[model samples]
Every structure is written in structure tokens, then in C-alpha cells.
Target: MRAGDTAPILAVPLLLLAALPAMGFADWLTLSASGLAMGMLLFLMASGLTLIFGLMDVLNFTHGAFVGFGAFIAASVWARLPGLVAAPGLAANLLALAAAGGAAALVCGGLGLAFERVVIRRVYGAHLRQILITVGAMIVAEQMSVVIWGPDALTLAKPASLASSFIVAGGAVEKFRLVAAALGLAAFAALRLVLARTRIGLVVRAGVEDREMVEALGYRVRRLFVFVFAVGTALAGLGGAMWAVYAGTVTAGLGGELTVLLFTVVVIGGLGSVSGSFLGALLVGLITNYVGFLAPKLALLANVALMAGVLLWRPRGLLPLVRT
Candidate 1:
């Protein structure tokens, strides 16, 4: 990549430096930790969409449904295992979280398979129809959630072990946020490893570059599509589960509310680029936290401003994988 190409990566460090003078070092550290945690959550929510959007070429508005489902399902897990969730033991807390995340992934992954077969298969290459049908599906799914879980917002308290903060360099960093950041980094590294070093990754990348050619090579591209879609939704569900834990609440509309931010991350990071999405998410997370703290009123507009600015400076996003 050219230096010009890598310039966008500097935005995070520069943003960090820019904020130091505005607050005390400890305050800055706390906010930075918060921002990092939020960014990772955003990345978790948006990363799967990036894979589907870039690899599948399908416009799936129902992606939010998976997120909502993930959140509610995870909440249900915690509700059922109140003992484990509330236990002061770290092992019990970790078990509760693992179960919740696993359930979310499993349920959402199954839903993704059904979605790919019933809805997405028919609308291949048709953006408008894909948008309409998927959105309608999302609405239906949301209503189903209401029927099953009710319309009330559900709260997901962090497990006892992750509920407190520890002092780090005179700043208190929430243990949960630190865990989120670590998980996000692990997910990113895993994705990079799979996409760059494995045979399935090679095939997926090839499919992204030339689907017809892959099919012609007898690679069963259709199955590949289904696999991608399933995995994408699963990731989104996992992200949703984590987000519910982070935010302490999950509503029927949680996924819908996050859709805008997910798209912003996808767009700014480049439509199909995971690495680009990572950077875009960090920029957004930090920008929102800093601006929300510095200028409360602009919080709503902070992400949009960042998106617009990035687009004006690099219309193709930080690392656009596919040329339009």
C-alpha cells in the first residue's frame, strides 16, 4: 500500500494526541479506554455486514434482526442462569458469558442459513429487491421478537467479575471494556489469519474477485455464498450479545438502532474491507466518545461528520477492496 493509502491509519493516533490538551491525563485515559471498547463493539456489529456486503453482494437489512435476536437470547441466557451471572467468581462469570455468546451464535447462524435460502437466493444481484425483502423480513422478525420476548427493553448486567474497574496508570478502566477490546482484537486477528492463510479464505477471496470464474472452476460457489452468509450473521449475533453486555440493555430495536452506525463503519472502512472497517470503527468510536464528552450536543452528529470528512478526503474509504 502507498503511504497515501496508509494515511488514514494515522487518524486514530492523531485523534488521541489531539485530545490530550482538552482534559486531564487520567480523564483522557478513561475516555480512551471507553472509546476503544465502544469501537470494538461497533466493529463486532459491523464486521459481519462487511463480509456479506462485500462478498455476497446482497443488501440484507434483516441483519439487524439477527443482532436483536442475539441480544435477547443472550439476555435470556443470563436470566436463566442468574446464579452464574451474579456469582462473584470469575469462572462463573466467564461461563455465563460464554454460554450467552455461544447461544447467540448458534441461533443466529441457523437463521442465516434459512435467510440465505428463502430470501437472499432469489434476489441475487438485485439491490432494490434485496433491500425491500430483507427489510420486510427484519420487520417480521422484530414483531416475532416482540411476541416472544415482549416489547419491554431487557437489561443485561455485566457479570460480577466484569462489573468493576481497576486503576491503570491513575485511570480507572472498566474490566468489561478491557475484555471487549481484547476479544475484538482477537476476532480481527483470527479473521486476518483465516482470510490470508487458509484455503477457504483463498476461495472466498477468489469468489469476491470473480464468482463466475470460481463456479466455472467447479468450486461450488453457491455453497460458498451460503457459508459466508451464515458466518456473517453469526458474527453479527456474537457482536450483538457482546454489545448488550456492554450497554446493559437490549431492546427490540437495538439492532435497528445500530444499523446506521454499522453502515457508517462499513462505508468509511470501505464497503468490503475488514481492515478498513476496523480503522473506521476506531475513528468513529473515539470521535463519538471525545465529542460526546467535549460537546454533548454534537454527539448525534459526530459519526456523520467523521464519515463525511473521511469520504471527502478518501472517497474510496481507508482501504477499498473492490473498485466500483
Candidate 2:
């Protein structure tokens, strides 16, 4: 499938333009920023799956487990460092945020390594088994989280610097959301850069083309796969941590609840394409907010409708990396 089309790129601006007439300029501004922020968070969650799917070709149902793990882990970090998290100073707030995100990523990545070694390595080519086993693992992980964190939802407060919204052109944008968007954008850029301009990316792509040939070239494909899986899970965890901050609460089922949306993004963006996931996320986010505003009753079905429409128009998605 072609991956260079610019048509899909216009979806965001077009949607923004279409929504302008329905609300005031200020409202539109606020909603636009909100949608962009939402899209970024979704991107963070889905991007890892794209990488795993593209290179390793594994259907990892346990991806969501990492998200819940990250959120809970970050919550624990905040609880342990109450002073840094609650401080009004930016430096203190950043330190706390970094610690939480870093810890979540590390823990989730470690879990991914163990999971891949114990379970995933055995079911490399079996899609059905991958789905079933990973789903089972996800359930087990969720239950374990409940056992460790307790069954009650845990409240998470943003650092003082990010707890409030700032007004720009009469529109209010939460500081946390802005930071989340920036983080997501940076991740996207970095992933693109690494994949397109690095030797590791070259080897990965070469492996995707011919595993035996790459192995003949003395590259350890299996080790690379493990690394990719770990990175994917780590990204999911980081995304989950950011999401927890945004939602202000953490629950064991938080990740499971978002599974459908995450898959929708993966499918809509074209499985295995990071760029596609980014665009798909933005599309989902914008459509959701717009539909929520215009027809409150249809909010639940907005994503499905959008997915259906996109599929009808482009069966392979906007920028599929591989033929589906």
C-alpha cells in the first residue's frame, strides 16, 4: 500500500473546518485543543502496537495490561513523593512527572521482556494462540493489579503547575493537556527519526523483508524482536501514565476500557504504520469531540461510524505498511 499520500493528512484540518459553524470561535478553539490532546494520548497508546505488528507480527493482547500497570505504578510514585508532586514550582513538578513516567516505563518494559520470553517466544507465528494467550495474560495481570493496588479506584492529582488551565484567545487549555500533546508529538518524531535514519531501523526493516537473510548477516532477529516488544510495552505504559494524570483516577480496568478505541486507531491508521496511527488517532479524537458536541446521544457510536466510513472508502486504511 502507498504510504506517502497527503489526503489522509487533511482529515484533521477538514474536520476542524467543518465544525466551526456549529460553535463559537472560542468554543471551537477549546475543543480543537482538547481533541488534539486526546489524539496525542491515543497515539501514545497505539503507536507501540503498530511497531510490534509491523516488525514482529504479533497480536499482543497484553498491551493494555502495560497501560494499567503504568498508571498504577505512577500513582504509587506520586503517593511516595507527595512533596514533589504537590509543589507549585515547575522544576519540582517536572521532576515528579519524570520520575513517575520513567518508573512506569521501566516496570512495564521489564514485564514485557519477561512476558515475551516466557509466552510470546513460543507462539511467534500462531496468530490465534497469540491472541488467546495474550488476552489471558492481560486478565491475569488485571487481577494481579487488583490484588496489589486494591479494588478501589485510586485518585491521582496533577502537579500544581499542571492542575489549572490557561486562557488563550478566550479559550481555555489545560496545562497538562498541552504538555501531553508535546510529549506525544516528540515521541512520534523520535520514532520516525529512529525508524527512518538509524542502523537499527535498517536492520529491522531488512529483517521484516527476509528473516533468514538477516540472520545470515549475523543479526539476532530474536533479540531484536524482544527489544521491540519491550519498547512497545514501555511506550504503552508511558501513555497510560499520561492518561492517568489526565483522567485524575486509576483503575484496574482502565486499559481494558480503552481496548476498542486503541484497536480502532490501529486498524484505521493501517496496522503497522506509525504515521497512520498518528493520523487515525487525530481523526478519532476530533470526530469524537465533534460528535459529542453536536449529538450527545451518538457519542458512543461516533468512532464506529467513523471507522465504517473510512473502511468503505479505503479498505486497506490510509497508509498500511503491509498488505492486509
- TM per model? 0.96, 0.95
Off by over 4 Å in 2: 1-4, 209-213, 216-218, 322-324
**180, model 2: CA deviation in Å?**
0.4
Cα deviation of 212, candidate 1, in Å: 2.4
Candidate 2 lDDT over 1-324, as tens digits, reads 254588888887998899999998888888889889989989998998877877778888888889999999989998998899889998998898899999999999999899999999999989999999989998999999999999999998889988899898898899989989999999999888887899998777676556778899999988998998899899999999988888889999988877778888998988788888999999888888878887989987999998998888778677766431
Residue-level lDDT of model 1, residues 55-126, one tens digit each, is 778878888889889999999998999999899999999899889989998999999999899889999999
Alpha-carbon shift of residue 235 in model 1 (angstroms) = 0.7
Worst 10 residues of 2 by lDDT: 315-324
Question: After superposing candidate 1, which stretches have Cα over 4 Å from the reference?
Answer: 1-4, 322-324
Which lDDT values do the candidates have, in the order given? 0.87, 0.87
